[model samples]
Target chain A: MNSVAFVIIAIFTLAAALAAATLPNLMHAALCLVLALLGLASFFFLLGAEFVGLVLVFIYVGAVAVLIVFTILLTGRDSREHRGFNWSGVVIALAVFGCLTWAILKAQSLTIVPPHIRALTVRQIGQVLMAGYVWPLQCVGVLLTAALIGALVLVLEEKR
Target chain B: MTPTLQAFLIVSAGLFSIGLLAALSRRHAIFILIGIEMMLAAANLNFIAFWHFAPPPHPSTGVMIAIFSIAISAAEAAVGLAMVIAVYRHYRTTNVDQFNQLKG
Candidate 1:
């Protein structure tokens, strides 16, 4: 059952990612991004990262993808022009893929006996985050604040 | 056959490659941002796959890292789109080839 689900979700994710990468329409690409992100969230769940998966759904699909769409709408430009095929880009992508595949295949496998993990819950995650990971959490909070301020400063129209 | 960690890693590699293609080939700033997002998602997927397969002592570490990565990308996407808006307003175009001021 889980394997079937994984196959379905993986296919959805890859297809959506392909569309997001290749679609000529920016709006269509943004919509595809949402689908890809949602599919990723499902992958997280399949891997037993439940809390993180839910957060991915909320923050990525709900917030970031929506933000991309809003930016497109607010810019009010026709961003549909295809830049044609980039031969150099295709070559680079293939090169990178080859390198990565070779490296992944050459590397020694580290498949340890799966350690016994106590069932993880949202409460456990929150506790651990606030306890052990508080410093990094605070730093991310600062980064988020900075981003919000920077965005506002950039987009806010000056009254002439 | 049940999906193995190698299967997940292969998918991630494919996604990353596709994303690189998007980021490199797309002339539009927004598409580049989308590509970057895809790459980031691929990285997160890799992290989760390793965490699940290895089952670390601190089991949540992978998830924790994934969370932080996602948070950072969210911030990145906001700032990046804001920059794209500013660039569009200034140059009246988003095509990478047309922008000539940066070539020194």
Candidate 2:
């Protein structure tokens, strides 16, 4: 049952990702990206990282997807079709996948089944974030602030 | 049989490859950014899978890193889109091939 669910979700996610990658319509591509992110969140749920999955949905589907759509609207649509597809990228991507799959198959340790464990709780995550990871947390906070300001500054209109 | 760690790793590899394809082939700047985001998400999946499969007394380390990565990627997407918009304003088009001013 678990493997079955995994296969289904994997297929769905890959399909959505392919659409997002190859769609000619920008709006459709962005929406497909949202679908792909949601599929990823489901994979997180399947892995028992419920908090992480929820956060993924909240941040990715809520904030990031909305931002992408808004940016698409703001940027104004381009009626012209993009140039022909670049086949070299397809070759490179396939080669990378083959290499990664070969490496994964060669790793003897990776075939082990997952051990039963307690599901991670939000409280545990919060406690760790405040205690052991406080410094990194603080750093991320600063980085987010800098990013927010930098994005605004980058888009701000210059005075004549 | 339940999926093994290798299965998860392979899935992520496929995802990462798709992302690479998007980043490499797409002419639009937004598509490239989307591709990068997908790649980051694939890495996050790998981290979570490893954390999940590790033996007892599992550390919250992988979960923590995934959370942080999500935050950072959000910041990255914001900044990247802003740059995209700025570039569009200047160049008046989002086709990446046309931005060859720096080619020497």
Stretches of candidate 2 exceeding 4 Å from the true structure: A79-81, B102-104
Measured with DockQ on alpha carbons, how good is candidate 2? 0.84
TM-score of each: 0.92, 0.97
Task: Write one digit per residue (lDDT tens) for candidate 2, span A10-32.
Answer: 99999999999998888898899
How far out, in Å, is residue B14 in model 2?
0.6
Each candidate: fraction of true contacts kept? 0.64, 0.89
Candidate 1 stretches greater than 4 Å from native: A110-117, A158-160, B55-58, B102-104
Candidates in order have lDDT scores of: 0.84, 0.92
Q: How do the residues A1-160 of candidate 1 rate in per-residue lDDT, one tens digit apiece? A: 2579988998999999889988888899899989988888888887778888898899988898888888788665666855586779889988998898878766678434445445678888899899999999999999999999999898776466
Candidate 2 lDDT, tens digit per residue, B74-95? 9999999998998888788888
Give every collision pair in model 1. none
